[model samples]
Target: MGVFTYENEVASVIPLTKFFKAFIIDADNLYPKIVPNQPQTEIVEGDGGPGTIKKITFNHGGQVKIIMHRLDIVDEASLTYKYTVLEGDLISDTIDQIVKEIKVTAGPDGGSILKNTSIYHIKGDNQLDKEKLKTDEEKGLTLFKIAAGYLLTNPDEYN
Candidate 1:
């Protein structure tokens, strides 16, 4: 198998605690509320902590797609979250798995900085589409903005 890693950083005006709470701690609850055509998420195994498995069902394009994720780490004090895509339509014949790590820290100007690393494990010597990966990265950033906007509108949330 071959592996590829992609790293991205996004700065948010929201505070570290609030951002972390909304984005990482309460993501399963918050995502469906903030995103359009809300995705359905359920805990399939284990507690909400490490080793838990989550199933997410969402509509992509005109088709329904499901994704399963296994939580590797969920640290609240350090504001770090990690998960690996275990199965579903997101995984193609060329891809075996995708592991994602996210860390939120206090940024300058009283905001927060979110750093994300995606490690893709490919099957055999297959290669991934760079453009598709870039688009996925942009979508991830858009999710951050969506959460920030939701928090901005609802001041009492994730406080």
Candidate 2:
């Protein structure tokens, strides 16, 4: 299998702890509430820590799409989280799996820096679809913005 990795960083005015808590710790509960179009997440197995598996279902273009991801790492002390998408509608025949890592750090001016890395494992010699990758990245950023907006409006929610 072939692999491709992409990295990006986003700066947010929200504090590191608050952002991490809202975006990583409470995402399953917060996303659907804050963003009406967000996916519904349910823990399928294990606790919320490492090795946990979550099933996420969402509506896309009048169709339902479900994705299952397993938690690889969840470190509250360092504000780091990693998960791998093992199965889902999002995984095409050319893709074996997708691993995502996120780290939140204290940025200047009491803000936070979100660093993201996505590793795509291909099934064969097919080239990675740049359009799909960009669309996924945009969707991720949109979710981040929605969570940040919610946290900003309700400062005491994640604190």
Candidate 3:
């Protein structure tokens, strides 16, 4: 297994309360709209609460679609959400197993930090390439930061 971590910090013009709600509550619903470049994410089954599950269809830049089912979700607090990928095209098609989590926390002064962690279990039954995974994860983090920064500016009308 290999682990990758990525992070970004943003200064929010919006208040913390509104920022948190937009990020934790509204973002999931508006993700597909806000990130039109990505695949469609549908909540096949979920409680809208901790331990809830859902199915996410990830569309790649090449229009390749991968359906991923949620394994677990833990609402640690007001703005932190942790989840794992149970099943998906990326898992069955490419990798054997994967675990991804995102943590949102209030920054020291007045902003927030969105950190991403991705753990991968390669399928080849051989040693994993940590550097390659880290590079890919870094690229993902860059995109995430851009998306998140956009959300901070425009929480509504994500659709």
Candidate 4:
């Protein structure tokens, strides 16, 4: 088996508390609402807390796929959230699962620093491409930034 990990840090001008509240706490409800022409998405189950098995569906070119994620931890005091992708088209035959953890902290200029760590577990003797994974992660980050931007402009939207 092979294990690969990637970590990234993003600094934003938004306050830490606001960023966490919008991106972490209210993401499920806020994401699809803010994005324009976004694919049909829904949280098929759970209360958006720990142990919640939430399934998000994505449709592209008439092909629909569902990704199941189980929330592992949600630490409000520490501003940390962790989840694992249980099933998805993103998971390859050689890949077992993906665990993602996000933490928000105060930045030097009173903004926020978002820290993300992703661990990919692979099947035996399988070598996965890291560049593709990085691209996917970057896409997610962009979407997150879009959500953050919406929250910044419409302060009362997610609150």
Candidate 5:
């Protein structure tokens, strides 16, 4: 198997604690509320914690496609979360799985800094598409920023 990894950092105006609570603790309930134009999400199994599984279905002109993610870690004190994409249309034929880790820390201006790491495990000698990976990272950063905006505007929503 081959492993490919990348890191991305996103800075937000929202506070670190609030960002962590909104994105990590309350994502299952907050995502659809904040991102109505994106895919619809549901917790198909477990209760939104370590070992919990979530299914996200995209509405593509009534043709629905799905992706499954399993939460692997949730650490409140450290403001960290980790999950793995067990099944998804985005996974290539040679890709086994994708593991993602996110850490939220206090920024210089009382906001938050998000650190994201993605590891792609591929089977055999297959090579990952770097452009696609970059695109995915960009998309994730956008989503995080949107969530941060939502939390900043509605301070009491997540808490």
Candidate 6:
């Protein structure tokens, strides 16, 4: 029942609406380009829009492998993405279930608020250490910032 949240954020020179419209809404394509090592993230069983399903296959910790399906997408006003880890890696069997959710909103000073919450299951006498989780998440999210930085600076190049 313990919950962990991780946030990856950057101040876009562009408007918050534009950042939310592009990055969060069209994440499947953008995320892969932004962070390639984590997931292949191809549209497999469905289209690119809402209700589409994609298979995400990637390596974890060199010894662990993972495959997951992204389920639904809600983009009425803000974006709320739901997914399940169909297959998991070696880090934690506690990951009986896993999901990453992002809640984007217009922030003060014309910035965007990118809030992420990850739900995962862990089992056995041993549990995930906080530092490990934070380090791993920070690395992955840092990549997102890197890509976003490039896009914000050279808007048309990656658009």
How high a TM-score does candidate 5 get?
0.89
lDDT of 1 by residue, 1-159 (tens): 999999999998899999998888888899989877888898999988899999998854533378899999988899999999999976899989999999998998989999999999999999899888888777879889888888888989887
Q: Give the Å error, residue 153, model 5.
A: 2.4
lDDT of 5 at 107: 93
Off by over 4 Å in 3: 1-19, 76-78, 92-94, 122-124, 155-159
Better of 3 and 6 by TM-score: 6
Best of the two (3, 6) by lDDT: 6
Q: Which parts of model 6 have CA positions greater than 4 angstroms off?
A: 1-13, 32-39, 48-51, 58-66, 124-126, 157-159
Tens digit of per-residue lDDT, candidate 3, span 1-159: 333343434444444555556655665665665566655656667666655666766655543356454645545465555666667555544466676666666666765666555666665555655676665566655545555667656756333
Weakest 10 consecutive residues of candidate 6 by summed lDDT = 59-68
Task: In candidate 1, list every pair of residues with a backbone clash.
Answer: none
lDDT of 4: 0.81
* Candidate 2 residue-wise lDDT, 1-159, digit = tens: 999898888899999998998899888889788766777788999988899999998855433388899999989999999999999876888889999999999999999999999999999998987887877776778778878888888887877
* RMSD list, candidates in order: 1.4, 1.6, 4.0, 2.3, 2.3, 3.7
If ranked by lDDT, best first, what sequence of candidates would result? Answer: 1, 2, 5, 4, 6, 3
Ranking by TM-score: 1, 2, 5, 4, 6, 3
Give Cα distance to truth, residue 23, candidate 6, Å.
Answer: 2.1
- Which of candidates 1 and 2 reaches a greater lDDT? 1
Candidate 5: residue pairs that collide = none
Better of 2 and 3 by TM-score: 2
TM-score against truth, every candidate: 0.94, 0.93, 0.68, 0.88, 0.89, 0.71
Please report, in order, the local distance difference test score of every candidate based on alpha carbons: 0.89, 0.87, 0.57, 0.81, 0.84, 0.60
Q: Model 5: how large is the Cα RMSD against the reference?
A: 2.3
Show pairs that collide, candidate 6: 94-121, 94-122, 94-123, 95-121
User: Which is the leading candidate under TM-score?
Assistant: 1
Task: Report clashes for each candidate as comma-separated counts.
Answer: 0, 0, 1, 0, 0, 4
Candidate 5 lDDT by residue in tens digits, 50-78 = 89898998764432277798999999999
